[model samples]
Target: MHISDQEILAMMAIPQQREEAFKLLVDKFSQRLYWHLRKMVVIHEDADDLLQNTFVKIWNNLDKFRGDSSLFTWLYRIATNEALNHLNKKRTELLNSFDDLENVMSGRLDEDPLFSGDEIQKRLQKAILSLPDKQRLVFNMKYFDNLKYEEMADILNTSVGALKASYFHAVKKIEALIDNELF
Candidate 1:
């Protein structure tokens, strides 16, 4: 049985139904959010940890959600922030440059048994990893998740024009990288 976001929110507003509402939220969004985090983090374990942290924050701040945007957008914003923060923390802790971290993540992707992508997909992911964080986020959301620019704007709190420009640059860079490697 499919439940709508409004139904979930309505249930959440009632004290008696809050737990059930949360369960529904988790069921509805977990896999999608996990993949979103996994694409960003590149390691299954790290993505899982970040996913857990995202849920914890969601549970803590559920009441603070004012429904200014769709539930999906709000949830995505939380997950995206968590992933970005986790990456930033890792970068800070390693005392390495962003490129160094990207190289490390690329190595992890190669070694990751859980990564089931074929060679081309792996190459694409490496190209994606080469992007700056914001561009990576924009590319992942638009290319993989198929979110609209307006939704991405809401989730990332940036203008649609900025997102379009970022995606354009990301695609150009990826195309250059892929063309160089493939040909």
Candidate 2:
């Protein structure tokens, strides 16, 4: 018989039983969460820093966590916000507006650290990087993360219907880019 996550979480709510539970969560989610951050920032060091920061936040916020959504949804919300905030701070450092930053990233795939991979996947990654930020987030959550629309809604703080529409548009844009070999 399997113990559900919520059951484990309940046990972990007691400070004495929390270490193993927290370790389990860290082990379970670290890589997937890290990759999520990597997809956005495209810098290995930055992703590593943000990944650690995300877990640190989880550790601090665990007690405050409302259990209103799944654990992954809560964590993804933190991770995504961390990634976006990192980008925004960096953008400000460069004295660029968010829109200006988007314009630059539109053509930046060839140089992004996170885009290092084999031919096909790298091509796909570049095309993904060309998308608007929300669309990229939606695509990553839906396609790579395999998150449901409901989970995405929680993480993004968007309605499920909006996520579906964003996903549809992202797929369409990717198809168009692929057809043109613009990746």
- How accurate locally, in lDDT, is each candidate? 0.93, 0.82
In candidate 2, list every pair of residues with a backbone clash.
none
Query: Which has the greatest lDDT?
Result: 1
Candidate 1: segments with Cα more than 4 A from true spot: 96-99
Top TM-score hit: 1
Worst 10 residues of 1 by lDDT: 92-101
What C-alpha lDDT, on a 0 to 100 scale, does residue 23 get in candidate 2?
83
For model 2 the TM-score comes to 0.82
> Model 2, residue 124: displacement in angstroms?
2.0
lDDT string, candidate 2, 84-150, tens digits: 8987687787684446565555456557655557777766777887787779999988898788898
